[model samples]
Target: MSETNPSDAPSPSDPSSPDAAFAQAAELQRTGAYPEAADAFRRLARETLTLNVATNLGACLIETAEFDEAEHWLLTAARHRPTEPVLRRLLGNLYVEMGQMERAEVEYRTGLAFRPQDAGCELALAGLLLSLGRYAEGWPLQEARAGLNPGVVPPVEVSFPEWQGEPLDGRSILVWYEQGLGDQIQMCRFAQELKARGAAHVALGCRPVLADLLATAPGVDEIVPAPRGETVRIRDYDVWSRYFSLPARLGTTLQTLPTAPYLSARPDRRARWSGASGVGIAWRASPTGFNARNKNVPDDLARRLLDLGATSLHPEDTGVADFADTAAIIERLDLVISIDTSVAHLAGAMGKPCWTLLPRLHCDWRWLRERTDSPWYPSMRLYRQTEVGDWTRVIDEVARDLQARSAA
Candidate 1:
């Protein structure tokens, strides 16, 4: 890969170069000022007296989200230190982001051979395996990701026993929320299941915004919203489970993804959203397309979806659009059409009929690898990318389906 240097990329012959630049570059890397570090390294190109500086410079590029340039720099540095374990892991992560799953697996496996104890590489390789639906091989590795990062809640350790069935004689069980609202919604299914199993008191901790939504979850005895800086620490409970981890613990497979809708929205909210035909809509979101090579949709597509003469409510239209009124806009909707975001969860939880838009690679545990409908959300349908960035085909298919469904 060709290194992209500024037009005035520094060379060793320059007499005016400052001596502090080299030292500053080193400091920048240590301080995590990766972009500046990359820039400073490029500026000190003339002072390139060692391979260590080049490796550090390449790492800085990786941190700065310059993958193409990062690859070039690291590939060059790797030639000098082909035996460095970090380079292989870094290349593997880059491949993961680039959607080169097979290549990433090789790189990760290669790095693990040299540095098996590296938790980071272990976590990445496990995640890749799981994303590819290679579960038989991935589950053991996936365990390494537990508590690996900060801000992640630790998994509950059961010393007494994991309740099999009808444990609720009167014992309380804690239900831990994980990740996003969507994750929580999907996981809430376990709360009801826990209740049925005799967990009489099921305490839940989740984001405050979802308090009302969670209130509607059948099994929760208490809903605690976690505030910034304040954590929900439970003193005791007979059992515990992270919502998303429920399936894995319960031995869920692609064939059995808890298809029935376990959550239903408030009767009032449901009534307001009912009509002859309604479709929930969610367009843009961060991590919008982490799968399918990640194409962030433009506003134009939202306008097109709206123009389909179907009832449309923006999942993101909180004050951005002069949405006539939230209740009114949502009330007359018959179905939901959404991206893989919180709105999809909302629609599913509401038990409203919905068609979830999907990216090809998809998010982890969406494990609906090639299916058009998800077994996880009963009324929700899926429209997937035929090819990367090919939303037009997906849209046309959706349009045709809508016409046929409406006609039927």
Candidate 2:
């Protein structure tokens, strides 16, 4: 999310005016200086508690993770402008940061009530519901993701009509990719479900890196490798839909989800790691992109996993070219332990034992809340932080479990 600009802030014609100070604070926020922005906004709020000042102050506080202060300012703003959906959205985000999912859901719902077309709030509420395993409600709302900003939801240009719940018998459907590699891995299992519903041809359009790996997934008749910056023209498909949307289209609920192994490693690649054994570990998500900082296990804490005789599965350390290579390495390992990344999804998709470590803050919805096992991947176990930014306890618990399993 980009910094909030104070559209109502007065013109900065006078250098000494509160308007100028507000402008300065907004500039600081735009430049990623949260502490300074919060301070400036605080001073401005003391002088005059306008809706603009309160909302901007609340936004800055949220960025700085001063949740208590953020809640006060955001609530003040929301109370003043009860019909303003943006204020409710901001309050919802602040509650999410504070790990108050129930409160967050209330804020999101209130925002939606005020403005049903608020796509951001819809997506946020969808995530919260899905995380709580309320698939029936979540999946439908998740379609709002396509209405988000182009940067968040990449543009998909296709001529085919989106496949709603229409009968798939003797019909062809293209499942085009969206989101990160981990998301693609998680959602690709739906291809087999489509086949079960009698889709005559199930074609998957995916990133080139995953094409080889996902090709092995059952019920996929074709793999269309989506090259970066190049338009992929798929022909002879009766209908098309975003890959993630399939779960909703298929009427998936927690109990009805297909949880079987749907992917496999190539025999040639598996042979490359034939002698490999013991645990495989990945402690970091991709360093680039949104939420990378929150998803990573600290280097110091990660070393503890290495000390337990696990080998690093990072591409830099393993020299893996793509997911296919990673899947092969996982096939040879007895178990995999990873942060919330593609590796965990890959292991789970291949029906390998995997332990996934989840952060308390901004944890992905797929992991759900306080769950020890994943319904999406039956062989997967989840280890989550009891408190924010505290991996020491999580690592300690994993270490003890590893030792006990070794002794057994």
Candidate 3:
């Protein structure tokens, strides 16, 4: 897994050839060195085309969030090695990154059937199921990260309780938040459930922007911003559990979930947002990595919706153009029409009506075998793509629906 610098790619015209270059790229990718990996692969691809080169190039491209080119390499690799489980697994990972879970599941399941206990395959399968809201199926698969979660997360930097298992009647504990905002909102439902089981104070770990807005969310007693590596007072609290880990700790499935509106808005924002059938919109996430490819709708699509005579508020990066720094966006709008990202969660937590757009393949946990509506957030509606890259139709449908709503 030792990574070589991209600048270290063997010269294409060098007599030694593309195999060395590809091997070098693959090593770079393994070492978590992406930039170098990408340069190495690009060199190999220009001189000759091969399944090995294409697959590695595709993987590097995915790391760069260059889906257009990555898809081409992955598809080419798939064609060259149709029966290879490893190659197929790589495709599944790409699919998962692109928010295409159904296709990812197919690849993961196919690979799992051959190499049943493969940890990588299992984790991917679990994550795919979890993201889809397929709680029942995903929990077991997703547990592969049981030991690794702590390693990957930037440490809490404080000595505090790590909450796990059934509620200790009437004990206060910090319910730690992690991952993206979408995860925090989805997991907020667990806060109330924890309270019902004997948790009295749920001090939420949250970003400053979300603190006040989510204070009224169900199951929370307070909200605090976390400082990197800084520890805070536990003050009568017994433990902390990761937000997403709540479901697993609680033995929950979609059927047993507290599938109700568990989050509420700042009462002040609520009054201001009310209008003729209020709604919200968020069309982008931090535009880097897998999120960029999956979450952002085309800007023209966003502009088009504005043109359609919808009273659409620019739901992100309000001061500047395009969706960014969501708190400001949430403060202004009544409802949100957005792709599946943190903004959707923020609006949902505010108890705002949201229409969430989903790619056809979708994220792994969004599940291939499933429902259009999200059980995690009752106020949110799901609109999915019928085919890949066909966002226009979905956008049109949403625009038409919103336009109709505006008229009514």
lDDT for each candidate structure: 0.62, 0.83, 0.64
Tens digit of lDDT per residue, candidate 1, span 1-408? 222221111111223335577667767676656678788888766555345456556666655557688777667766766656667767776676566778989988887887785676776787787666665566556656556644554455546454443346678866666666666777787777666656679888777767666776777888877764665555677766566455555555555555565555455554443443455466665552233224344567666767776544553544422111333344346777777776677677656777877764334545335576666677778777766456777778877887787788
Show model 3 residue runs off by greater than 4 Å. Answer: 1-54, 58-88, 94-119, 131-134, 140-152, 157-161, 227-236, 268-280, 311-335, 361-364, 367-370
- Candidate 2 wrongly placed segments (more than 4 Å): 1-40, 43-50, 63-65, 97-102
- Specify the highest-TM-score model's number: 2
* All candidates: TM-score: 0.69, 0.90, 0.70
Listed per candidate, the RMSD to the true structure in angstroms reads 7.4, 4.1, 6.7
Candidate 3 on 293-375: residue-level lDDT in tens?
A: 65568878877776765344444323322112344445466567878776677666555678888865434354333466666
Global Cα lDDT for candidate 1: 0.62
lDDT of 2 at 143: 91
TM-score computed on alpha carbons, candidate 1: 0.69
Please provide, for model 2 over 1-408, each residue's C-alpha lDDT reduced to its tens digit, 9 standing for 90 to 100: 213333322111123345778778878776657789889989988887667778878887776678899889878777778777778778887887787888899999998998996887898889889988899999999999987756545676767788998899999999888888888999899888999899999999889999999999999999999877777777868898887788889999999988999989998788776777899999988865446666789999999989989999998999888899988899888999999999999999999999999987678888887789999899999999887678999999999999998999
Candidate with the larger TM-score of 1 and 2: 2
Per-residue error for 364 in candidate 1, Å, reads 3.9
